[model samples]
Target: MTTPQKIALVTGSHKGLGYAIARKLAQQAGIQVIVTSRKEQDGFTAQQRLATEGIQVDFHPLDVTNDSSVQQVTAWAQKTYGKVDILINNAGVNPTMQAEEASLLTMQLETMLSTLATNVAAVARITQAVLPLMQAQNYGRIVNVSTEMASLATIGSDYYPLAPSYRLSKIGLNGLTVLLAKELQGTNILVNAYSPGWMKTDMGGSDAPFTADEGAETAVYLATLPEHGAQGKFFAEMRKFGGPIALTW
Candidate 1:
């Protein structure tokens, strides 16, 4: 008998960490990877690029912040892939609120609200849409791409003002991870969050310590984990060019 193939949907996968994660997933056999982007053209191009490298990939257009777009993508996932065995919520925004702008950053409603909408709300919306499919499969792995800045254990009072919007939004995302894990307990589905660390991506910036591919390692690992894997925890890179290990919640 032929082994069944698992389907994975990775959001904001046109470039950066999301693209790397989608590529990593496609590298493994029996895993059909869906590479998504808010821009339909980007998604198509990414699929083509990966196909050139002999990867099995498909394109999907998704805008996590928009309800209609999220619903349309989720329905498309169901109709085409039948089920999304793994979900990598890798889409996020980190507005460049440099130290120079610290004083007014907090009060900047556009930056703060936009970050929350994409980083927190969209994560929940997409998960809610794909969750029933995961439940139906009785096996699912959801990896919420988070950041170390979100860690309360590490973020002292002094750190509160740094990237306030992005940090707070991730903390919110982490809460969703815990809540979802709890709701899906005693089942095969597992939900968790991990930090990809500073990588050389548009979001991470050019001076970031690592490359996008390196940063995506942990998310890929969590995406393929077994039923007994870690749940509702945050992870970060420990060793140089290594995968992520659990960090404090």
Candidate 2:
């Protein structure tokens, strides 16, 4: 019997960067792409749009921040595909404002908690939920969509004035990536965090320098990496960075 094709789940892909990533993955033959969003309508719309382009895709509603929702999606994947070979933790939120005026206390208590819940905690939970399946197959690729703004090396330098909450969340995400990689050290599962650069998306904004297609490049590359490729590292535009470096947390 022929083996079934690989499966990929990309969250927040109803549009923008997530949409681009889903499209790219679908374009590859034999790859089943799951395009997900918080809303069923949005997910179906994205799936239909991709189908029009002759790309094989399915719609799944996933609200990364919600545990019940996460479980439902993972269960669906387990039942339908038996495993999720690639998981792109691309869902994130950035309610922006000037750093100085933003209440550090409030930011940490409210914004930071909420941001981490979705950007970091959700990623961790979902990865854990799917890890058993990967271990069974001895194959998995996890790409956490991170950002250059998360780089502590650039902080206090020329690139410091970006979205603080979003930055902190991704920084936490990078740390999680490292920890998971170390734990799964000898396994075939490869986990990495990537900064897609500033792109023109709802999150990246119109004035951003890169396009969604350009932004999705690193993510797609990392998703499709060979078993020998690097894991538990931070990457931006193909250049890997060292250590977790500090954030203002």
Clashes of each: 0, 0
Give me the runs in candidate 2 sitting further than 4 Å from their true place: 1-3, 98-108, 238-249
**Candidate maximizing lDDT:** 1
Q: Write the per-residue lDDT of candidate 2 for residues 172-192, one digit (tens) a residue.
A: 998898899999898889998
Note each model's CA RMSD in angstroms. Answer: 2.5, 3.8
All candidates: TM-score: 0.92, 0.90
For all candidates in order, the CA lDDT equals 0.85, 0.81
Looking at model 2, the pairs that clash are none
* Candidate 1: C-alpha lDDT: 0.85
